[model samples]
Target: MSLIDELVALHGVFAAGEYSYRGDRFSYKGHVSEEHARMASIMCRATSMGVHMQADIMAGSYPECGVAPAGGWVVRGPQFTVCVMANVFCFLDNQASLNAVMSILRTRLADASSDLI
Candidate 1:
């Protein structure tokens, strides 16, 4: 299914560039930033190239709320940006089910960010 179709299946509220999964909301503002869109876009392209998987904008922060950022949540499946500044880039991992692949993604992102240092 297409991203839009996959997104609708989640019963989320969709808008110009945002979506909410459950009570935990995600917007194209604050932490998520445009990075989410960028990531989703990458996932979409990869999926199109035989990377069977799911993609969404994951939540990043909520310190005062003391919520596990891993419960990071998601936006709709339509692959859209959240904001520009990440505040902090958090992700809800796939429960160690894909540890090997996840490690690489983390390393790449970290290495990519070295330019910012």
Candidate 2:
């Protein structure tokens, strides 16, 4: 199965998608609409950029902080959470799903370049 399909098939995952650094939606699966997915891509790209910037700053200042080369990020809310790795995004319902989803994403996208800015 495709990565998107695999993620959506996981329990508690309601949506999954992939995008470019330019915020272009590549593909998506599950419950979100096309419009929302596009918007989500933009948001994810922007947030990832910000995260990398912060990591860079931390690395430069601390040198041994181990914050550089960020792998991914997560935004948690009371009822939902958004997990992002490389250019892939997944919407999950709980913390348990978050761990499973991130593990899969980190392993599957291990070689995905994070230098796209």
- Candidate 1 positional error at 27, Å: 15
> In every candidate, how many clashes are there?
3, 0
Give stretches of model 1 more than 4 Å off.
Answer: 1-32, 51-117
lDDT of 2 at 85: 91
Q: Candidate 2, residues 1-117: lDDT per residue as tens digits?
A: 888899999999988998888764467888989888888888888898899889988988999997787888999999899999988999888745677898899899999886874
Roughly what TM-score does model 2 have, to 2 decimal places?
0.92
lDDT of each: 0.28, 0.86
- Candidate number achieving the greatest TM-score relative to the actual structure: 2
Model 1 C-alpha lDDT per residue in residues 18-80, reported as the tens digit of each score:
232221343332233476644543443333222111111122333344332221222222344
| Local error of candidate 1 at residue 34 (angstroms) | 0.8
Worst 10 residues of 2 by lDDT: 19-28
